[model samples]
Target: MELEAAAALGKYLGAGIACLALAGAGIGVGNVAASFLNGALRNPAAAKEQTATLFIGLAFAEALGIFGLVVAMLLLFAV
Candidate 1:
């Protein structure tokens, strides 16, 4: 019984650590947006050309957050 309790505790702790990736993803998204905005403000004409890249960066950042969520879920329920 004590071993089962220890396993459960470990799983919860691991899940919590995995969730930190979400925080990193948030910071990454913010940095990408800030950099794009800074560049666009300086060069209004070029902003149109780089819009696609900006969106790609945002998508990647969001994907990372989603991946983190999945890992946490799996750790909590599957492992």
Candidate 2:
């Protein structure tokens, strides 16, 4: 009802919304792994060769999620 209360509510809501980025990151990581496995299944020999690529993709995707989480935490605690 008060202005400060409204602002605080907004901050919490914004932080919650920012967490949605993690969901997108999760989906992206899942897609990357799924595609890699699909290709690996079809080519067993090359699967070994592509393991590094798969992990790199996974790390990149996860990094985005971690960044999103940091943003959410900053919103909740910093601003």
Candidate 3:
């Protein structure tokens, strides 16, 4: 029973770590988008062509967040 309790505690801690990663990702993605928009607005003509690239950057940022969520799920289910 003690061992089982320990395992459960470990799982929760692991999940918490994953959640922290997600929080960091949220902040990071927000920074990325905010900066991109600020820059785009300041110089719309040049930035027009780069819109696709900007979206790719945004996707990559959000993907990192999803990865963190995946890790959390794995910790709770796979481990």
Candidate 4:
């Protein structure tokens, strides 16, 4: 019973951390978008080139958010 309670507490704490990662990812994605916009404004002709790189940046930022979501799910289900 004690072990079960301990596991439950640990799982809940881990889930909290996982949720925090989403906030970090949000900040990162915002930064990426802001930089891309700034670059595009500086050179309208380079917007096309910047778009591709912006997507790559977004993919990485979003992947971290997805990982956090997966961890939250795992904690809720597997734990």
Candidate 5:
């Protein structure tokens, strides 16, 4: 029984740790946006060309957050 409890605790802790990736993703998205804005302000004409790249960066960052959430859920519920 004690071993089972310990395993449960570990699972919960791991899930919590996995959720930190979401925070990293948020930071990444912010950096991407800030960098794009900086570039845009410096060169307005080129901003239109780089818009697609900005969206791609955002999508990748958000995808990482989603992946982290899935890992956390799987750790918590699926073992």
Candidate 6:
């Protein structure tokens, strides 16, 4: 009812919405891993060579998730 309460509610809602970005990151990570496994199964020898690529993909995906979390935190606490 009051302005302050409504603003706080909006901030919380915004933070929650921002956190949804993590879902994309989760899907990206899963896709990368699944694709790597699929390829590795077909060519076992090449799996070792692709291992670094897989890790890089995982790290990038995880970083996106972390960025989303940070944005959510900033919305809730700072903005």
Q: Find the number of clashing residue pairs for candidate 1.
A: 0
Candidate 6 local lDDT, 1-79, one digit each (tens): 8999998999899899988889999999999999999999999999999899999999999999999999999988887
Report the Cα lDDT for residue 63, model 4. Answer: 96
List the candidates' TM-scores in order: 0.81, 0.85, 0.80, 0.83, 0.80, 0.84
lDDT of 4 by residue, 1-79 (tens): 6998999998998898899989999999999999998988999898996788899999999899999999999998985
- lDDT of the candidates, in the order given: 0.95, 0.91, 0.87, 0.92, 0.96, 0.94
The number of clashing residue pairs in each candidate reads 0, 0, 0, 0, 0, 0
Model 4 Cα displacement at 79 (Å)?
Answer: 2.5
lDDT of 1: 0.95
The residue pairs found clashing in candidate 2 are none
Record all residue pairs in model 1 with backbone atoms less than 3 Å apart, i.e. clashing: none
Name the TM-score of candidate 2.
0.85
How large is the C-alpha RMSD of every model relative to the true structure?
1.7, 1.6, 1.7, 1.6, 1.8, 1.5
Give the distance in Å from residue 52's predicted Cα in candidate 5 to where it truly belongs: 0.8
Model 6 pairs whose backbones collide: none
How does candidate 5 score on lDDT?
Answer: 0.96
Question: What lDDT tens digits, residue by residue, belong to model 3 across residues 1-79?
Answer: 6998999999989888888777878897899889888988999888888888778888888899999899889889998
Off by over 4 Å in 1: none
Q: On residues 1-79, what C-alpha lDDT tens digit does candidate 1 reach at each position?
A: 6999999998899899999999999999999999999999999999999999999999999899999999999989998
Residue pairs with backbone atoms closer than 3 Å in model 5 (clashes): none
lDDT of 3 at 4: 88
Runs in model 6 with CA error above 4 Å?
A: 1-3
